[model samples]
Target: MNAVSTTSAERVRADLVRARSARSARESLIKGLLFLAALLSVATTTAIVVTLLQQTISFFGEVSPLAYFAGTKWTPLLSGDQQSFGVLPLLWGTFYLTGIGLLVAVPCGLLAAIYLAEFAKPKVRKTVKPILELLAGMPTIIFGYFALTFVTPVILRDVFGIPVSEFNGLAAGLVLGLLVTPTIASVAEDAMRSVPQSLREGAYGLGAGRLQVALRVVFPAALSGIVAALILGASRAIGETVIILIAGGQSPSMSLNPTGSFQSMASFIAATARGDIPQGTLKYETIFVVGFTLFCVTLLLNAVSTRVVSRYRQVYE
Candidate 1:
């Protein structure tokens, strides 16, 4: 009986060892798969950067950097004496639209976030927050149409009596602001909500009013996150292609007039997507230069965000 019991105990031990080994192997396989998935994202980004840089270099060979950067014109396809490719017009147009978009988004979004975070009852929050966020998921093209058909004519024309073209930067920027508002509101609300409740309570204990506690205590604690949210909103506005494309209209000009039709970097890329010139020609290569410029701007924004977060990140107890 003793020998039989020993043999059964050894068999059970062997089965347990095998089970552990199988589990370890499964985990190892999953880790390997996850690493490859991350690597794929890195590889794709590297490929794009390499492709754009190579073409941009080739473009510089055809068109001098001085002419591309300093000149005010952007008519790369213009015949004979009219050809130019200055980048300022595109850059300024992009900035003008993005600036106007931020104006519309930032205050409204921050105010909404403040209400949801500090003031709203759970029932009201539950009802309103999701609907606000739903705006982010709505297709941008729809917003573009709304900008052109309704915004330009009805709001700008009828209410303000402002002169607005069929497709103007002001209309596009306002609509883009509405499109970007959800992103800012969602991120900023999360930031504000993450503030430690103890801080709020302490402020209250010190005889602070609700407004004072919320503004002075909670808002300061969440400043870094709020800044990050604003950065994200700015990036979204800068990269937006479809809304600007449909509503802002593609006529590259160095004008700051909000009511005037202007072309954004995104719209420029979209306008030239058809590769109107033969491959390897100077006209064809202009797209790559523009693309590279956009990429650089995005990279700069991300770098600034990283620096801002690191410099101001709170060390909480």
Candidate 2:
């Protein structure tokens, strides 16, 4: 009987050893996979930066950086014409449109976020939030067409009687505002909701009104996130390609007026890349130079967002 019990104990111990070995092997495999994913992401970003730098260097070899940056005209592809590489016109158009878009998006998006976060009932919020986010998923091309067909002709021309061009910055910027509104609303609302319930209750105990509480306590608490949301909206406006390409004309001009047709940096890149500019030409290299400039702008915006968040972020137990 003793011998039989010893043999059974040995068998049980052997089984336990096998299970531990299997678990360790599985854990090691998962760790390897996670490491590989992180490495791949870093590698991809490095490759993009390297490629853009290579082309940008070649571009600057022939064209003066001052001419590329400060020249008022951008007519490199004009046949039999003195080539101009000044990026100011494109920069102006990009920032002008983005400013118009922000004018429309900021107030409207903030109000919507306030309503959803503070006042809306649970049922309404659940139904409305998803529908609002759905607007973001709609194709930008459709928005472009809407601007060209309905906005320019029916609304701007008929109702307002503004002498807007067929493809103007105002319509494109308005449509771009509508496109990014949901993004701002969603992010801002989440930020506001993240404020602790205790703060709201304390404000109520002081006999503060709902509006005062929302604006004073909650808004301040969520300022970091709100600023981040605005920065994100600006980045989206700056990087947009299709809406501007379709609605905003490809004409590069230094016009500050939104009623005029103009070309944004992103739109120029897309329009030029699609055309028959042969590889290795100055015109072709302009694509990368413009792209690098855009990349730097976006990186700066992200850095600002990080700094703002760090400065203003609140911590609660």
Per-candidate TM-score against the hidden true structure? 0.90, 0.91
Model 1, C-alpha of 299: deviation from truth (Å): 1.4
Number of the top candidate by lDDT? 2
Q: Tell me, what's the RMSD of every candidate?
A: 3.1, 2.7
What lDDT score goes with residue 231 in model 2? 93
Per-residue lDDT tens digits for candidate 2, residues 222-266, read: 999999999998999899888888888889888877777989999
Instruction: Score each candidate by Cα lDDT.
Output: 0.89, 0.91
- lDDT for predicted candidate 2 compared with the true structure: 0.91
Q: Which ten residues in a row have the lowest lDDT in candidate 1?
A: 275-284
Over the stretch 73-98, how does candidate 1's per-residue lDDT look in tens digits? 98887888888889998998888998
User: Which portions of model 2 miss their true places by more than 4 Å?
Assistant: 1-30, 79-81
